[model samples]
Target: MLRKSLGALCAVLMCFSGLASAAEVPSEIKIGTLYASSGNYAGVSMAQYSGLKIWVDQKNAEGGVFVKPFNRKIPVQLVAYDDQSNTATAATLYNQLITQDKVDILAADFGSVLTSVAVPIARDHHMLLIDQTGSGATFFSKDNPYIVLTSLPMSSVWPKHVTAFLTREGPKLGIKRVALLYATNDFNGTQAAALRDAIKATNGAVELVYDNGVPTNTTSYTVTINTIAATDPDAVVALGYVNNDIAFLRNLQDSGTRFKWLFTIYPGLETEAVEKNVGAKGLEHVFTYLPSSVMAYKPEFGLSLSEFRAAWDARFPDGKVEFGFNSVAGYTTGLVLEKALAATDSLDQLALRKAIVGLSGKLKTIDGTFELDEATGAQIGETQPLGQIELDEHGHLRFVTVYPPELATGKPVYPAP
Candidate 1:
């Protein structure tokens, strides 16, 4: 069984490889990571980290990365530590990655809070931070030269498409009162700020009634839901991760509080695990952001959306650890590093950073374009399309892209019944 599983993933996809003509590529490159290996978000983090490992393993299997300067190929090594879902521990571990472990490369954990810990350390050490997941808006404001997002869009632009859809469609449905609920962290904080600004621009067509940011670990939503309910919001927009989305939806069901329209962030709708957890009835008519795997996904890097999905299914056929496009996001991180390392032909932190920023707009991968406005180290490559969960003609629940007509797979269902 193990042999069969390993052989299935050897799908002849192109490895991001090129010869570096300058510094000698060592026998192996050490990539260090700090993620929640045993906490609330540990499972999600583990799956995300696996994306990076997938790419590294593939490269090693292909006889490592060739470096013309060294006249040899160098394999990659991953040195990961369990942050235990603590931000403070992540910070300390990052310092260890830089000093004690002395890793040549650093990979971010899973979300905004954990990734934020590495931004300062990378900048201070002048090492390139190949951000795999974090996309908080504030992180890009400082002109940080050491970090760049690989998978998700900058938080500043995350709410743009969804908010635009609401502004244009809300008045038609009498959705005057809208509530924004988010996790009280950098990722969701920035999302709430953006949503507020987007709604403000609608010129009173949609009223921003209840806006709240709750803790990331808080499962009970009675107090917040009550406040939200009092406003009688027509639509409730939530910015949460997998756990937050699950808890919020379940609590909303238990409280018997149903909104005409529902939207949440990163609900894991693309993964069946989330569907099984929330159940089809609980998830019916919920709207959220759909960046990929929603019918608008474009082919890039070495794989298309469908092809990538097949690859993931093949690798983890047990259905125990399936991830959405984020697995591709992690793989894209490795692609960026490979591009920069080859361009600079050196692993020296400063040199790699310069190489990466210079390759802005030049890099393209499975996630989308990799362009960064040098002025703000934020990636403005891809845009998301709003999606809603609805029953298809077959009467089976499925997430359909609704907004941005060009990429939409189906029309938006208002007052979801």
Candidate 2:
């Protein structure tokens, strides 16, 4: 049975070699990346690729990583494939990378659904998978040994930020009631649940005038907007992806259904896409949450953010940046893998695993110090930052912080009439 399984795995690996570069291995430090560079989520994958490329360039410039197997420093090589935004396709691509490509390490995809398939594939082949973008809580709960979640988990991502913002600005904005709208997708459902739980915890009398879920790809958001408008809530929170968020925002403006506050999830008011399409007039006082403090656009971290963004912009001059978590996900994932690799003298799979799990003992990133629980894959002590979008005098999108006063640039202005 063992022989058969090994044989099957080896066969899968060989398939990857067909298209892979025939270049000789200068050293044994090779890693694999799987993402949707085409198809539905190309925007996300391209941004991630840009960030990864920056790190790769930097590492190579520094003379690469020390590989135990090679007994010398070796440049890290990544065998990346485009999963094309299809879950099944992503799974197969990842399997080929792990079982066939024989990549020493694996990097997961950008979102929850994509990562769901990538995680198990990595575990099956005993490759250490570092997740920079996926945030579903299920990844943390599952009994997987070869996985590390490097971003803010959704289960606790938005609730606290939203609740704190509301508590601070609710009375000021005269917000007594609100509506919750979400898409019936994993991303929206997770955010909606977090918002609901937050509202409950705060003891705020914000009535959930409309608690409803819409189909994921519903084109027309007019009915949804009209329904929520009819409730006369002081605020409306739409938990959605970029498409859904933009649809609802445009629909609300077209119908002229005004609200004091418009809370959103995913690529909400903070992103360049939302700002450009929704416009300043459309989202003057909307609130959005980002997974880390970096999203606040704080000048305190200006030095670091500027350096990183400059590096990315240099490589991706086509203005193909992934606005919110995508670039951060890819950039941070590279950092995590580098850290794990540095602890060991070798590229051996088992040694790499020890370095990763060893990370659980002390989790630190440019974002902040957090820990990966040994028992649970969850990263502890990480929190999301709250932000609001408004146009600057130059008409460029500006991100203003509204929570954690130490990092906040402006106070929350709610109940916009």
Q: Which candidate's lDDT is highest?
A: 1
Show model 2 residue runs off by greater than 4 Å: 1-26, 67-72, 167-173, 201-204, 266-270, 291-303, 321-324, 345-354, 357-366
lDDT of 2 by residue, 279-354 (tens): 7677767777755434533322112555676676677676656445566557666766777766765566667766
RMSD of each: 10.2, 8.4
Q: Looking at model 1, report the run of 10 residues with the lowest lDDT sum.
A: 12-21
TM-score of 2: 0.83
Residue-level lDDT of model 1, residues 1-417, one tens digit each, is: 888766665432222233332323466888898768788767678777877777788778987755433556678888889998888999899988888988988988987888987888888888778787788877775567778776778887888778878788778877888999888888888878988988998889888999877888887776777788898888999887788888888888888877889888755334554666777778888887775544435545556667767767788888667666567677777777777666765667667766777777776666767777676667777557788887667766787878887867877777877
Residue-pair clash count for candidate 1: 0
lDDT of 2: 0.68
lDDT for model 1: 0.76
